[model samples]
Target: MSDDLTTLHDDGVLEIPISLESAGNSLDGDSIRNGTDALHEVMRGHRKARAVLLVGKGKNFCAGGNVAHFGGADDRRQFLRGLAHDLNTFTDALYATQLPTAAAVSGWAAGAGMSLALHADFAVGEPGTRLRPAYPGIGLSPDGGMSWLLPRIVGLGRARTILMRDEVLNAQTALDLALLSELVDADQVYTRAREIAADLANGPTGAYAAIRRLLMTTYSNTLSEHVIAEADAIADLSITGEGVEGVNAFLAKRAPDFPSARN
Candidate 1:
């Protein structure tokens, strides 16, 4: 990996390797500014990336914010607040891309680390992987969208219990709760995530984006309102080259070659 640890593969998957054993990727500090910049490039459609793959390199996927830094700051309150703004900035850029995303989460995902993994549409982990809503343990509430994401993935009641109780969830439990989408062996986590992300990149990128939009907004819409949104999405999609190619491929009885229709 290079200084920024970001690479765009030939397959149209943007591979961002989180290294130094925990990405220590604070939403607050400068540690993740490079990633934020990369995501901004994607949002501008300059990267030509169809999907994103996040790989964790180390014994743990991420240990969250560097606790040492947390304590080192002289003005602790201002420092934390600044970090919050940075975290929000990074996450907002990632969300704006509307691309399919996956993560190779191989070991302990704690504190902001768990929140980061939750951003992925699919998180591939090992059987030994673990998740902990470690914010409270550090005398803080959740950041990095943890508060919003947990409830959506596991339900409000269950999410509440987990957060309030500061639970350390095992890999199997995390998978069962839909927190981790897939589980493989420890060594295969990154490979599996890349495979899945590449497959997504080759798919109908526009449709995947629409699905992400629908799912993210579903809770805010009632049945009647949601159906209208769904109709609008498909109607808009039908007029695109991707839609036409999909229909033609189906009629021709062959798999869709979406890349050929890429604009």
Candidate 2:
């Protein structure tokens, strides 16, 4: 755990909770940079985690960007550049990670905060939680991969309606719109996400990574290119220790032990 308020707990499952002193519990420069760095450290490097469960502390999962720090100055530009670099690095690392990721939202997730939650493989929000896009309200556009991910999750028309209107979508509506995978009780947000992460961690790591890669590359790959990629992925997975264990475990009717291997 870091003194900045973000807590990382390991209890048979890895849990990363975002707690900040900014609006909507959103991450500011210090919070985002420090928390992202700390997560890489705790996970023992980028993409090393078997699974990740992202949660929020207190009431809101996140409210969005910290407007208090927004200003125009040389110092501000430098800060903004550094912040963008670090965040993009962290986000890219997370996206490239070999593990399954889940977001557990408790209350309000607006603006960039909602974008962060949407990045997860599975998004779980409480019934009373609110999901909104507040960028247009502030005369700004989307960031934090929101522009790319929003349209993919919800169609272009629906995404435009949400972002343009800056409307608040409740948990059930978000679920109906495919913004969330499940609607859970507020109290069970973290617990349920942890369980989901644990389930993924217990599965085949290499195969999971291949699946993630496939999904990520789908948008850019041509039909012929995708076929080649699929073949490459299958061939790559067949040689890993995980592939061997997967087959053995199935034949033996026993659980596989995917202990960490140091090269």
- Candidate 2: misplaced stretches above 4 Å? 1-14, 21-24, 42-48, 71-83, 259-263
> Which pairs of residues clash in candidate 1, taking residues 3 or more apart in a chain or in different chains?
27-86, 27-87, 28-83
| Candidate 2: tens digits of C-alpha lDDT, residues 98-208 | 567788888888877788788788888888889888888878877778888888888899888888888899988998988888987889987787788777766676787
Q: Which 10-residue window of candidate 2 scores lowest in summed lDDT?
A: 5-14
The TM-score leader among the candidates is 1
TM-score per candidate, chains pooled: 0.94, 0.85
lDDT of each: 0.84, 0.73
Q: Report each candidate's C-alpha RMSD, comma-separated, in the order given.
A: 2.0, 3.0
The CA lDDT at 84 in model 1 is 75
Q: Write the per-residue lDDT of candidate 1 for residues 172-215, one digit (tens) a residue.
A: 99999999998999889988999999999999999999999999
